[model samples]
Target chain A: MTDLLPPIQTTARDDAVLKALAGFVRQEALGPGEKLPTERILAERLKVSRNTVREALTRWEGLGLVERRQGSGTYLKAAVSPDMLHMPLTLAGGNDFAGLMATLEIRRALEAEAAALCAIRAGKAELAEIERKLDLMEEAFQTRDGMSSEEDWEFHQAVFRASGNPLFEQIIAAMYEMFHRFWEHPLGVRDFGHASFPYHRTIFNCIAAHDPEGARAEALKLIATVEDDLKRGAANLKLSDRR
Target chain B: MTDLLPPIQTTARDDAVLKALAGFVRQEALGPGEKLPTERILAERLKVSRNTVREALTRWEGLGLVERRQGSGTYLKAAVSPDMLHMPLTLAGGNDFAGLMATLEIRRALEAEAAALCAIRAGKAELAEIERKLDLMEEAFQTRDGMSSEEDWEFHQAVFRASGNPLFEQIIAAMYEMFHRFWEHPLGVRDFGHASFPYHRTIFNCIAAHDPEGARAEALKLIATVEDDLKRGAANLKLSDRR
Candidate 1:
């Protein structure tokens, strides 16, 4: 049982400090412009050196977890995702909505690569995994009469894993995790096909058949379809404003 | 004199601990296969409690700076890139190559956003700054009759700033700092229009006109052109194989 929990076993004093700080901020539901506890008090409470506290603070800074004031203590800034994709966005210090769109563009590129590589790299085991995710997604689509957000994510994650590149695998994972809110808080019902399954199936087919061009085409078609929705949605807002 | 030193000003005990460990690691010139000092000896030499040392080690783990094994002490891992672009390809991770191409593809998406935003958001001050860079680039092109890698970077740096989106601005700054290596390192001698300045000017011209469509087109053309060069140069083994 102890060996099974290697991930959280030690958790390290500094990591504990960070996790504590994050949890406090999260539970309070702070946003940008919120204040955090003073380092001296936190240091005393955490029973670690101020130096150790400072390192944890730096981790928060690197993650865009807080806005530091030179003479004042750090304040909570953006709410961090419970996922890794948001880590790089924060690590890169991008917060604006336009920046989020830029992140999506990056995803487009990775998804294309994922499709192409999945075509070549995915073996029978990986193909079976993709097929399993596809079936799960289809079931979610059928039962929910809409794509469950979690199911949508599971399908993408499967593709990334199939790419045979751990870096791409993890980077894509981090990105999806970071953008969980945008996905979960749907502006409208997601189009599973007309609304999800063919794009998924087409991508899966290309991978299973080991056809790179077909995979790339299918991936682009998926992104293009989504971008179309975003465009129409933006236009509809303009029309509603005019009315 | 103190200011000339690295940013290690907080506490001597902690700084001494970190610096000593850094020295020990450097002595081994640690790489992927490298092993590091044991916690017992490291604590003894640093004159800190094992708990304090463990906290410091945890900080390194968070940054992916070191790895820990169940039976073994922590091993030295590579540092993350400060200049994100020029980051050596191997830093993409020893085990992943296809992932790297996908990552570059992602970067291109972010770059396109920066260019498009620069078209809309740039002010007169920004345009003037871009023009100033253009002047220097012209000087390099006309007088030197060869590449001006420094000027080449300055031009793009100006464009990222012109975007008025600090998120894109800083990202491009960091990424290009890494990409600048290709300018001086390999002389593919692609030619004037094909090289940096001409394409940059075309991009500059579109942005100056506030033509978002034109700007995006120009930005993409320049990127596609370079990507072609990257693909060709890597294939020909002229760009270090990017392997």
Candidate 2:
């Protein structure tokens, strides 16, 4: 029975303080615009230093959970519901497989839209940069031994830039970082047998032709290929576990 | 001509240090596995303290631009392309219209998928919770209010939770916070004549029937309504400007 138990995960003192403060607010049934105890009082009640309380309060304020009046005191500005407290998408450090899959799905949606937008909005300079990247990719395929993840990343990034939406670029960049850090293989790595070049060419052609729907379709197909690779990888892990 | 120019946005010393380091790396054309200069050397070259250099390096590491090896120096682990440096999605503070629109489009994509997933995966308790939230929404519509943003928020949050992917919930929560902070009107606010209640009811019916496509369609319709409202609001602003 003891062996079957899950390992205990210790919470940091600061996190504990934050939880205690959040719990206190819940227990008191604090509503929006309601005043919270002063830092000194919260510190005394929670048995933590005033600095710890202040730090937690600052974090809460950033999360829009609380508001601090300069001359007055901190007040509850938003009702921190149970669902809000259970937010699991902290892109802090490290990555889990499920989180990676979730991120990939998000990428599928955003990148498809980005490709469509790029087809509509890309200027001559932006289109030339994308063409340059594709040419570099072709060169790498011909000269180098394998596909270069760096070149592949640049190609996609160029498309994002051409989308003219900074938000898409930023989200894609963050997702790329997370995927790169977590996966054992670098992003955009195609196996020797995987004919990914044709898909890239198709996507490029769509953009070059200024076909938004076609670009979107090609992007989705590309992501679906990546998804299939991930699923196969996961299946292999399960097989190894059984063996 | 100089007076006609926009005011310069002052860069903080730390941000300036960070930018300078990034610029140095770019100018040097640093590639993967290339070791950076010692902290002492970097600080000396950048005309900043070692602590500032360390701080900037730490930020770069978090952004996945570099890697620090134990017993060895920090090395450039990724190609720092110009586009990589121009990532615009800062979920920091404040709200810009373009950012909000980007977030809304992302929401449309993710939430539609989430609703579909909820229809397929939601357990009994989760389904019950969704029903309860819908009931609360109806009550809000019936009495005490025209349309409470809080109730609307909770209703959508419940659907996200029922989707069984914490990633969806977290992303939605972050977007909600951003939208809430920036938009003059709270998220999901509609005019009394807008008749959003029927759409919510339709979504709930689809989820109850486990119709993934129906749920998705209804979710898309809801987002489309919001998008139309946003477009109208923008048009009104332009007309007012003309007036």
In terms of lDDT, which candidate is strongest? 2
User: What DockQ would candidate 2 receive versus the native complex?
Assistant: 0.08
Off by over 4 Å in 2: A1-94, A182-196, A239-243, B1-89, B92-94, B182-196, B238-243
Q: Chain B TM-score, candidate 1? A: 0.57
**Candidate that would win on DockQ:** 2
Residues A45-155, model 2: lDDT tens digits: 888888667656655654456788877999997666432322113432124455567777778877887888899988889989999999998788777755555677788
| lDDT of model 1, residue B58 | 59
Give the Å error, residue A89, model 1.
5.9
Tens-place lDDT per residue, model 1, A58-147, is 666644456667688788755543322221322332333344465555566568767887898889998998899889888887887764
Candidate 2 chain A weakest ten by summed lDDT: A85-94
For every candidate, what is the interface RMSD in angstroms?
10.8, 10.9
Clashes of each: 9, 0
Give candidate 2's error at residue B72 in angstroms.
Answer: 43
Query: What TM-score quantifies how close candidate 1 is to the native fold?
Result: 0.50
Overall lDDT per candidate, in order of appearance: 0.62, 0.69
Error of 2 at A96 (Å): 3.7
> Of the candidates shown, which would achieve the greatest TM-score relative to the real structure?
2
Every prediction's TM-score for the first chain?
A: 0.60, 0.58
Per-residue lDDT, model 2, residue B121, is 89
